[model samples]
Target: MNRRDFLKLSGLTAASLALTTLRPRALQSPTRKLNFVILLADTMTAANLSLYGYPRRTTPHLERLAGRAIVYHSHYSGGNYTTPGTASLLTGSLPWTHRAINLGGLVRRQLADRNIFHLLGSNYHRVGFAQNLWADLFLRQFRADLDTHIPSPTFIHGQEKPLVSQFFKNDELGAYYALDDFLLSTHHVVNPTAGSASMGYLGLFYGLSNRDIGTADAEHPYGLPSNGYYFFKNSVLYDGICDTILDLHRRENPFFAYFHLMAPHSTYRPTRQFVDTLVEMEFPTKQFHPLGGRTNRRTLLEQRKVYDEYVANVDAEMGRLFDSLDAAGVLEDTYFIITSDHGEFFERGEYGHDTPLLYNPVIHIPLLVFAPGQSQRVDVHTPTSSADVLPTLLSLAGKDVPNGEGRPLPGLGGSEDGARPIFSVEAKQVSSFIPLSRTSISMVKGTKKLIHYRGYEKYPDAFELYDLQTDDEEKRDLYAEDTVTAERMKEELFDHLADAEKTLKK
Candidate 1:
């Protein structure tokens, strides 16, 4: 068969497989076990949401849902990007412990079994899915513990090329590293490819085919939303999620489902209805960092507008999904949690989360928990980390909370600690196996935040301190003025770093 014929046949085969695999089994009476659903939105920062006091009304749906849910106001992610941020959430440990610090990296083999899936155990039906390839690696790592591992492209539309990860299910990680990352690498800007000449020719054809299939329809005016790997529609994804939840509701056992959706991350393409609908607003101008991307303020504001619109679009679909599930009585026995892996940045001359700066916009994420039969909203202003999620979930499941850096989240079987230290690490440039020789660590203790930069040529051993209570914008740097607070925080930060590095030796 010709190349065109081969591609077409592959597409048809994939569709057939999806239809057969996704069809629900014979329905059974629901059990008494509690259900848990974690809905993660990639690169969604609380700073951009009206739910978190942003001037723009970007999340009306989430705001309405918060009426009966528990909202966390001061939540931070473990790292600036997907690998480490997601690893922390899954393992209930910081990036320093899990060592998933690099792009497309996996958790340390020794700590492999210490994830949420294993903690939930066989009593509950564990399910995992992620649209972001980087976040999907964690699911691939713990596939053995999962009762249902959904394919990344199961809900994606207009897929022409066969995915290496889907075909080689048993060895998805290795296959992805070899074929998708090296030989048939189409995503080059974020991930490096081996640059095979023959594969490049084939990739060109694939791109053309994909473009033809992924043309903007009437529903999506700007374009179909993508995760840099494939194109998908927000409505289709949400509908699939609702269907999955309904299927779970009919099952005999309780379930722990993690759906990591790729929206409002990048390539912000909202629907026609959401585009240009947000009020134009100005953000506070901050000094550019030496390590920043140096993007102009006007461009940053413009990108923020588009990002806000995309967030609104995602929120609308989420509202639909929740309403459908509630109508189906799925919410009666489920604990629904909504959060993000990491957050986006649009200030200090940086347009995305790729920069080394560990500012609030790039690390502060939203956390909302909806308990069964919840009626009144509960707000927790105590600072929390993504690492806290795993332990909290276990506690809610009536399981023993494991020993880790994270304690159960406040208002959920854990007490609030106002002075608790929350740390976020950024070390994409450093090797995951080695001790972190060069990195940026931000320590948030109560309302004060101290950012320490180590082993960089431009700003070696630098420090920036901000009292978030007073300067939430982080306009004023209090490193020099607040000598007592600065020295105390600096010492605490370094001492913690020293302790984390010591684990590498053993």
Candidate 2:
């Protein structure tokens, strides 16, 4: 039986009347105030994008847009995964301070009031939505500051699933994980959207309906392929985003629209044209460390090939979005920022971004700003953190950066704090309120970097150093080779951690 039919038999559906409403508020005069729109694409690593000099032509559309936008080459996510990375962007605080270190953790209650939405206040209509349930958690935490919150499922532009899911409110918790992957993952029949909890009985039906999509040799025949529980295609998601932007233009003047899209992530759903075009499909012959994860070279190459294709597909969708905004004349008055929550890794025996490793593939990301009235393109080679995004947006809106760890972007009335060590943390095993009891961290200053991995049962507490200017891939360990640099960076890393821990007491 299909998942929907199984759900009917199991009686797991709940009929709740409440539904999300995206109605426009009272129409007000367009007072020529600048609007801000953040296009947050989840799991889009910069290492794979052709815009960042990858061998594959993965991002031709973004290459076109980057000409007019301010692009940062060395931008890094605050955390290796969603919880910590998205929290850093919203809270303007690092993983240690915001403490979204756990898998599904939220920002600290004390610093919760200091988010971008709250800091922006009522001066503009603060709108927030994310297709990623993990990122949506942070938005829900900061919901008090939002003027309107469009639902994530609304991003699906075309026909939704069975009619029953529409009327009944789905169990959101069910969407968090799927039982289908237990047996069906290797065979692969159920698409990612099949896990959504919003459809109530329909969600359970999705759980029940893992159809026979043929063997692993045959890719998706009818349903979309999926790696995680979330099911959203970038093309449809981008269509909804374009529609959202134009709709907000019609709303009250000066709106802060934060649309976090789930695209270019896992399950690598690239269109036909983008698939298998690249020459190299085999994994690298790099020395095998046999560390944390189980992915081999062949698996890495397979995952990366599709991931690049999916990234290219998303880039094309972005091109359409830009065209729509330009046609509406909203681009002239809107501050558009394109970035990702975190990156994925294909190296170091890892397939996806679930590992605790903070390698360059997992942390390095793309950051671009198409500020209003920015006629000429600018590039910032200096290193920056995702934590700076909130303050940079604040600065663009003519507001102060607040007393947070982030500084504004260089082009937008901010300077590169290269002297101040930038930090990245991964603390999936620890609680949000407790800081630094068990965590993985990276400290970046100038060309030197130091990474600390602690509390992992597989990996002991250790410090690894790398010269980013020389080793961008972080394959070489410079800890023993460069003692002077390592010691200095270690001191800075611990000091920053100490400061972050002190915030907990306050």
For every candidate in turn, the CA RMSD to the true structure comes to 11.9, 12.8
381-432: candidate 2 lDDT, tens digit per residue: 6678898888877876667778988887655657555587778898887877
Predicted candidate 1 versus true structure: per-residue lDDT over 329-357, tens digit per residue: 88877889999988998988898899889
Off by over 4 Å in 1: 1-31, 160-162
Separately for all candidates shown, the number of backbone clashes (residues 3 or more apart, or on different chains) is 0, 9
Candidate 1, residue 115: how far the Cα is off, in Å = 0.5
Question: For each candidate, what is the lDDT?
Answer: 0.86, 0.72
Clashing pairs in 2: 2-209, 3-205, 3-208, 3-209, 4-205, 170-198, 170-199, 170-200, 193-231
* Error at 340, model 1, angstroms: 0.3
